[model samples]
Target: MINMQMRNIGIMAHVDAGKTTVSERILFYTGKSRRIGDVDDGTTQMDWMEQEQQRGITIQSAATTCFWHDTHINLIDTPGHVDFTAEVERSLRVLDGAIAVFCAVGGVQPQSETVSRQANKYKVPRIAFINKMDRVGANYQSVLTQIAEKLHLNPLPIQLPIYENDNFAGVIDLITMQYLVFDESTQGATVIKESIPATYLTSAEEARTAMLDSLSTYSEEIINLLLEETPIPEELLISEIRKATVTRQIVPVMMGSALKNKGIQPLLDAITYFLPDPFELGSVAAKKIYKNKSEDIQVIRSESDDFIALIFKIQQDKESGALCYIRVYAGSIKAGTMVLNVGKDKKERIGKLYRMHARTPEQMNELKAGDVGVIQGFKLAQTGDTITNGAPILLESIQFPEPVISIAIEPKTIADMNKLKEVLTILQREDPTFIHKENTETGQLLISGMGELHLDVITTRARDEFKAQFNLGKPQVSYRESVESSSQATETFERPINGKETFAGLTLSVKASERGSGNKVINGLSNNVLPENYQAATIRGIEAALSSGITLGYPCLDVEVTIEDAVYNEDLAHEVAYQSLGAMLTEKIASNASPILLEPIMAVDIEVPNEYVGDVISKLTSRGGIVLGMDMNESIQIIHAQSPLTKMFGYSTELRSQSQGRASFSMKFSHYEKKLS
Candidate 1:
């Protein structure tokens, strides 16, 4: 049971929805921690990074292993900010299931919706937790309605909140028809089960019946029992609910306030009872190649199958140098074994393996198929590399968003240059979306990330961890250039190189691609004329040319290039000349291709008091934002809009002032649109 009993899950939520605090409670309750850790005081176990502690927010995903009811739970706590959404994306890619925490008052916030959509894209089964129920204005019914309307989820309540006036005492289980309350005297350790309180008996019975009726579709036995008015047993109901949960047909909703230390134990029980195990996901899919033919197939999760593990994350441990985290899918992995990184076509040796709890590493000799563990000394393995013992079977890699904001940074002292480069290189390897580059023309070093906080974390680490002081410049939006019209051009490379004239003629066509598709290079020329090696070189050059825009120095995007025809002599043909000509001809074609600038547009969600709704609307209007929709939830107004990133660099500070510190908001990348002149 220790091997297949494991459940790989993540706790996801919006900012300030108590995701970290809930993680601490789970760790403490499951004996992973001696006492609960607080995020506000910077004592949390999951938010262990120095930056996270100082800012009182989670920036990276932390993984840990604990047990409850003889079931091993491998949990990952992910960041809630939109800037660090890639963290959530990668976590969901490997997890078997998730617990999406929603604030009862601020039900279905922006980031909550964003992460929910991310989970849906991966087909991850999840349960809903109505967190912060202890706070005032915690309307459970409103949040449930929003879940159905906004998240498009089929939600069923498994528990009903028992509130004594404004204070939340406990919850009544709808499945077993019992009242369960946490003991405050024992610090929520003792659970007392008794008869349903007289005040909530009517509502509880109605809820229990409704829950059973909805789940009848999953089990024929339950349907027959309900139709016959027979008393259904608890096991029968739970089994049917588990069936629906594993299939992701319905999301079972539970309520709790993690900050108050109430309603955590039941949530843990729900996780063990409902979420899927690695073995239950049946077979893991991987792309395998045989005889130069590739197909997508499933790899069964079993100890008998060949070893397959995916490197989901990479961190630079202070004492261990490089620490790699992997989810074992097919077979067991042990220390002192060699695995091939099928994506890189390189072999890597597993040195020492460890199970990581936050930043702490515990040495382990082996890990089972469903477990998560770490390894070190993988010099060439990247974040998404697939390591396998069998033939080259590559797992589908995680996709990351491109960086849209950048800033120039330079060492304050010349002695810090090498250290700065080394530090940034390590940071780049850790986060795929974090980009590091140097301007050859001006000799300026620049780092690009998703947002201001992302860049701030990089600079702070450079200063604290590496002790490399640096001066940073102002932030700038990373605009893109795109083709606006179809055009054709022919260029003949008849230049003299090394006292020998290298002549090659190439014709190319350019057209505007759909927005958000990035750039593409289509080879319309016959292979006999252009050949394979030269075509590859030309594509590389086209990619290089797209990095610098015609309107400004920004990168180009959403454009397609086609190689119409080319003439080259095999006796004197060189790939190097075509590479240079490719970059050269791309720029020549852009001169008349009607290039246009595109700026990153963000979808913004704001919640403010009704009194400040007018002010918020006026400010967004001045910043070139159109109000997408507005809704009222009690006294607060929810406003959504699409605004260009250029005008939103420092809008947070201004928004706090506009709403008198009562309004808050979050934004995420929506689409890239043409920038107005």
Candidate 2:
């Protein structure tokens, strides 16, 4: 029955597309919330962070549960800002489907395309909700065209908007030939279905025909009914659409002004009716080791089967400690159950389970297959960990990009020093993208993240949530070191350990790798001369030595190390001997390889009016920018460029000044390039 009754879904869209608003409406209509909370007022339930409320954007992905009909829907609302794409990434990793929200006026924005690609990567089926239709210049057809052209989607509109004097009234369901108008007096809690109006009949018919024509390719029954001119049963049509959508063959489109309370009920109906139930998605694939060899196999859902789950999110909860949000894939788990964290190779007991609604928690006794719940008592739990009760199975984990910028944060007073360090540890545990480091030479703590806003959010949280008062230092660009040319060196270590002569010799080769291909080391020695464990020790030593570059103490990147040769006394062929020799050779390799500095280049997207195009371009170019692409969006010019991160400091201020505060931009780390001489 879990196969037919569960929908693990999320709400995703670009910023200002009304995703949180739609979520608010869902929570209220489903009785999860007593009253609607508006984002403008900073009272939205899904956006629960103070930074999120003040900035009016979601900073963390929030999960909640509600019922739609007989089906249980676990909805996750994810952030839309480019810096927080990591949150979106981890959420999509565990979700079976999503709701793609599009602004009727803004259409398919840049982030829209980005998230579409992310969904496609995870093969998550989605239904498109055309929102903000009540706004002026809200053209449904225009968005449809953009969805097809920009996102390369097969978009099928199942509902046609009913506009009265350019104001959104309701929607005309194409399949049922009925018009739906929400009860304004009830705040859209009740729906009144009526016959299609005479003026909208032609458009509704055209839309239904278009939808059926596209869905026909996936179902022979639909083709037969369409060819015979027979009335297509709504259930049969919905089944076919569900099949095609779950396979990502097509995206069903629904229209609404979520903030104005229009078309939300039908959208919810579509989610349960069209998205795949967990059992329908069937088994999950995991890697198992047999006879020291790994193979991928399916883990089907069954409460009686072996327990398996993935920890896709980790959050620090005041009431429950670390709330590890798990997506159970194969079996049942409950309090007191002992599960092995296969990724960490450690065992942990499930202390308690919770059903989260933003900051609120509802305690549960157990969770079965395909359910999402939070659990505590896991001190070592981390995002992307696979935990199982029966066997060791490894699932593909989420990959996060390296942090591109860093800042030094020092406590304002001696009393807050330990508090700041403790909170930093908590933040690092919760967010895998957040990296903390210490400047050993200067005795200062440095925190690194994807962008400035990311670091700003962390510091703000450090102050507000943890009460760790701190002062921020200048934002620092994260530089890297790489070999500019191929070079080789040799080192011999002769030492006395425990009154025994320990001698080891090794040769290392350094070669330049393609830009963005991070540091790597490989054993080029023959096992006949060296043991596998000793070679492994050498690799570990090389990795450690590369962490601090030869010049300027930056981390190394885009370089390759090779263990060209090695010789050691059989009696003294120990791990330490090889490791010591390896470290010595790495220093020699760095000196001979012509190590050079590499700086991060960010992919920036800027949108501004035509009048300010020249000014914006001039400012970007002055920051060592290179124009990659440009397009015209209505009256705005969208310029895509790459610039060194060092030159992008205070860009937001300068751009607003250049464009009279009417322009906006988003940027993310792109690639590492050689610093200009």
lDDT of 2: 0.88
Candidate 2 per-residue lDDT, tens place, 569-590, comes to 7886667777877876786778
For model 2, what is the error of residue 624's alpha carbon versus the real structure, in angstroms, after optimal superposition?
A: 2.0
Q: Please report, in order, the local distance difference test score of every candidate based on alpha carbons.
A: 0.88, 0.88
TM-scores, all candidates, are 0.96, 0.96
Tell me how far the alpha carbon of residue 289 in candidate 1 is from the true structure, in angstroms, after superposition.
Answer: 4.5
Query: How many clashes does the backbone of model 2 have?
Result: 0
